[model samples]
Target: MTLAFDSAGLGPGFADPVFDSQSVFRSVLNAVAYPGAIERLAHRPGAPEGLDPAMASVVLTLCDLDTPIWSDAALSSEAVSTYLRFHCGAPLVAAAADARFGLIGDAAAMPRLDAFAMGDERYPDRSTTLVVTVPSLTEGPQRQWSGPGILRRRTVAVAGLPDWFWADWALNQGLYPLGVDVLFACGDAVMGLPRGITVKE
Candidate 1:
């Protein structure tokens, strides 16, 4: 038997794979370390048609053959799956609970936060890291945030999230160290919201 490969809608990966991944990794690290602070990713991943540049960059930087990724319907195109498999070598999984990373292309229609892997009490690091695409990182209803990585409460505004997002987030936070971490991608900007963080309108 023979298998045919399709490259019709594939896009370019990192220009300098090693160096580019390192740079983006540092930016992501800072975002997670600073919580509410927005970090800019300088390199563009030349992602496929349906993927966001920032989201694509995160996948390229963090995922590998060992990571299982799950994507919402809007981002689950063949082009995207092929692009990620070729570039990041990450496997796409059907269930969010089995994914180490989850991508939400349409935040407004995103699934409930509890649907993802919340890890276990003995190994919280096993939880999923959700990368959600949003309209703008700086133009929405403001919310107050405080917790580890934050010295004091900070106000942040993010556009394109679902109406019950914050409420769901609060419930997720109640799970303590077992809940998933979130990364918001808006254009070239990215922000992190670790499990321990507190968010309020």
Candidate 2:
């Protein structure tokens, strides 16, 4: 995808505002705690125009020199990669399993959840994190979510998800200690689906 950025409010600089960093970290913490619930954020830094704000926020907060990131074909822009490398100091990896974090620009084309690295029983936290960018968070087919962070099985919808996404997610969850955690980003809204969550079609 060709990304066009509007930096009118941000001034003329490639760097995302410092406030964006703080907001992203705080929001992600809440997401991990709440799981499967959507949280809205402001000041989507490091994103080009038309790109999801939450996606930019995540790339800024989670990626660093110690992490490896893999991007889907749509998000494989030279500008995007350069910005991430220059600001976050993260290394870009070619393989999904080798990456600590993966960015999926096209939700329809996302790989099966099982394709990525799943943490072992001894270290469940070692699994990879997937960041998926969708068209919108509010409109789509709904799914039932029940897990540690959920309250009595809540109903939610994530736009741009493929028909088999939930099925793949279920299979991944069955793997227990060996499954990747997924984060969905639409505009400035985000929702986390940890490895433990149960998603029903």
Clash numbers, per candidate:
0, 1
Predictions in order: lDDT: 0.92, 0.80
How many clashes show up in model 2?
Answer: 1
Cα lDDT tens digits, model 2, 1-201, are 999864343312224557667777888878878987788876566555434667878887778898899888887877677666766789999998888899998999888877788877798778899999988766889888898888889788788988888888888989886899888898777888888899886
Q: Candidate 1's residue-wise lDDT over 39-141, tens digit each? A: 9998878888879999999999999999999999999888888899998889999999999999999999999998999999899999999999999988999
Number of the top candidate by lDDT? Answer: 1
- Per-candidate RMSD, Å: 1.6, 5.3
Candidate 1 matches the true fold with a TM-score of 0.96
Off by over 4 Å in 1: 1-6
